[model samples]
Target: MNESKFFWQACRLLWMSGILLVLISWGSDVPVSTAVSNISYATTITVDSSRDVSTSLSERCDTHTPCTLRRAIVQARLLAPAARPVLIQFDIPTSDVGYDASQELWELEVKSTTDPAVFRTVEGGQVTIDGTTQPHGRVDGPKIILVGPATGNKNGLIIGVNASGSHDNNIVRGLGFQNFKDHLTINSSHNTIEDNWFGLTSEGQQPYLRNDNPQDGSGSAGVVLISGAEQNLVQQNTFLAFDGVAIALRGNDNTVRHNQIGTNALGLLTLKQTSPSLLCTPEDWLGGGGISADGTGHLIEENIIAGLRQQIFAISTQPDAIWVQSTCTSCTIQNNQVGVDAEGHEVGVCGRGFYLTNTKQVQVIDNVLAETYHSALFLNGALYDANTLRGNIIRKSTPWLIPDDSPKGDDAILRFTGLPDPLEFFNPAKITHIEGTTVSGTAGDGSPCPNCVIELFLDDNDNINEALESVAVVTAKADGTWSATLPTPLADGFGLRTSSTTAQFNTIANISAGTTVGLSELYMPGYVGYLPLITR
Candidate 1:
């Protein structure tokens, strides 16, 4: 391939790797060398202090002279164009005053201005602010904490603006950002934000509570990518406890994968601040949520979102684990676990799994959504075309199920106001029988559109589809008949259910009513003495 082709391919591969795997750790930083190989010049700037003070432009970030984060950022921006890129590492002492009285925490306090305190604009791209170089950066969570001021709106960092697209390929990794209006705002492209903790404490155990005035300084969000910011990769990060959205995407073609939005790093515990009196007032969280996408062509996959719910006094509006607005066209949200933990168990409180309103050409596939108090899949607003929901396991949580205030029938999927054809979007699939390994289903009992795919799942002792594992997948014939035999026979007394996905529109129907498997349903084989006989 040509050099340009090779470069683009390498970048694509790098993005895929970032989306699929944890790209960085405390021992190593994001591959600045490998990512920008074409760049001839580079420099390293080491920050030794956790202070937010600026340094002279002429000074170098080396030993003998103290280098602050603010100074390193400014110097990197100035040197970035000529140097091509700059690596900013940390070397702050654990005993510095920046550390708490217990000496277990280290933070840099940036006073909030009219807008948030932007450490630097990151003029030239390819700048890496890696906190993994700090003393306890090797720990499971972040070590360097960037704390906002007591009052006023504070923003942790901003990268580039729309006017100038020079800021690209910048990276912010292994840091803890708390109490910022929008922790990190990006307007540039090709940037990677990985392995960071937002709205959480340095240890990543719980939400950061502002001690100065508990009711004040609640941040609007953790990360906000402006409209101009496209093709950015936000992966392997933890977002929780923000007053509003955790990650708000207004850009196109960004990929948010493997991120823990509302869950801990292990994807087990919820990091939401439950107490209304201690933090901001109860009114702050009305309709607040996990992830909101208003951009087009974005890929949101492999995220664990729970935590969101109706806060105190917020009766009418409920939060969603993931919200896709009308502007987000041609987006794909797949393999995500909403209202459920990494182990597929219902863990946290979520109002809805997905709230898609007026979205166009969006695809929701292969996601597990459970334990939501409201509808698991809610589609409303203007008429949208070519939107699809296929193979998603959405069900109410059994045993630990939250009571649904507004019941939209027994099914957890809800559709209203300008939906597609009923068979394609509103109708539920039907399970005729589940005999032995073979399972049969109907798409609305042989509707006009009969060609579809059916998926069978072992229900969790109820009519609702709770289990994440699908037992069988079968293709429905043009006559609306579908059957699939599993590898092993299903046990008697077990409840089985199926869902349908239209071949034409690719829309999935609500899960069918649970049918109990019977003992007589097992396929019997004839045997002669000790020899087994196979019969059709």
Candidate 2:
């Protein structure tokens, strides 16, 4: 063929590929320019009153008139199909309607269960409800609060109207949610919940004092992503002192990062109770922990979870800091500070750091856990296989087997079931010598690991891998011996550790005991205290 004819054919193929990509984006409900129109005018709505009144169909949102939050939501939902990506901002003054003078706060109570305080995105439309525009808000937190009803299981803000709707690409930010069964529930995908405070006052210094007279016994949750909700981001929020889990994540492919669970806003203090009368009853079923996750491809990272336990409740069992259910797979938990405060102080949790059962291909890496009353890592039985635990630091974890085990703190860090030879399955990399960046190690003990991958790290004196710098990676010989030369000379006064990954199942093991450069060493166990990696 001629050169001009060939170039014309190539251009045709490129145009066809672009059409196919647009179709795929629409099938996944992605907001491309073709799928969703950018309505610049008449897309911004403002709420000047804190009243919880419904709006009529004829009276849509007008920027000049006074509107309530519920009215703003109704107006946004009633927009034409062409108008989308609406922004609902607040401009309520101190003397606005529904503002309490004695309490000095603006509270929007849910008026009805049928039309609750919710943000339901229309199909192919997106919405953002921002409370940062409130005049009385603090510099760091929100000033407007959403309160639930007195006697029912009401949610503060729901992303989808129902399970049947594909309400996607909505955002709720810079708000305070309290006194609801669930502060927020997302039944849609591609939503973002950031910079919000759950179970706390707008100032983020105290819990919201509820006015429930009889004290509704329904448990509370910070944020809940229901099943089939995928690709959502829950970040930079404070979840404190709820009766149930801080984040009940039942979605797939979601990312929950940089949120404070079971702690104060700054993570410098432990969480306090939301109300003195709100207690967990014997029949409550959802009080799991900081994060109760049950789906695949989830990432829970960089959160501080501590002080989550009920002191006066009929069900006295405390919750795990992070619980991955049996059905989950390919989830990653990394860079989280569990069972401790942000300052590395021992603000202990009543349960284990991680409670994993029958999970497959889960990675728990580079987490620092301290002062857990139960074992730091708990695998229920032999059915839990093909999971990886690499570069974790645990201190002051106790053995908790039964209901009343008499609380021996910091005694054990691991509890795995039915491992006859624990070392064969859980062998840490052993560094025998390190001379001028060439580090040598025994990567295996027996048949559990062969031709393993040894990963070396340079942590700054602390045992934990804080900077996530992997200095070197080398493969072990079939005989279980390995050696790797780094790119640069090993620095003085810096600590080093190695983590081993087995060749057969690709399972990553815990990091070896740290070794200081140029220092002679006795044999150091992988775990610092009483227990080994697993117990029979």
Instruction: Give per-candidate clash totals.
Output: 0, 0
TM-scores of all candidate predictions against the true structure: 0.77, 0.71
Best by TM-score: 1
User: Scored by CA lDDT, what does every candidate get?
Assistant: 0.62, 0.60
- Which residue pairs collide in model 1, if any? none
Off by over 4 Å in 1: 1-41, 54-65, 100-105, 135-138, 210-218, 270-288, 310-312, 342-345, 398-410, 417-429, 460-468, 505-536
Least accurate stretch of 10 residues (summed lDDT) in model 2?
513-522
TM-score of 2: 0.71
**Angstrom error at residue 243, model 1:** 1.2
The digit string of per-residue lDDT tens for model 2 on 1-536 reads 12222332332243223221121221223223211233354478888877756534334456435587766776777767567777888888887766766555677765654554343333334777877656654454555777666643666777765444447777787677867777788888878787678877555554453453122222368888888888788876778766668899987988886677766555555333323233233222122358998999998876778766543454455788999887678898877877665555566676677887767688887787766656677655454556666666655522334434432222223334332234224654667666675677775344334576676756443322222345676777877788888777656546455656556633333322221111111122232221122122
- lDDT, candidate 1, 1-536, per-residue tens: 12222332333344323332323322322334233234343788888887655434344455335788777777777773667678888878877778764435578876444544556566678888877657553345556788877642667788776525677888887788877778888889988887788866566655665453333323678789998688888876777666578889888998887677666555556433445342223533222358889989998876777655434344455557888999998898877877665555565444667888877778887787766656677776545545566567655544323334633332345554345444223433565665566556555533433666666666544434344456666777887777788777755445555555556643333322221111011122221111121110
RMSD of each: 9.5, 11.9
Q: Where does candidate 2 clash, by residue pair?
A: none
Candidate 2 total steric clashes: 0
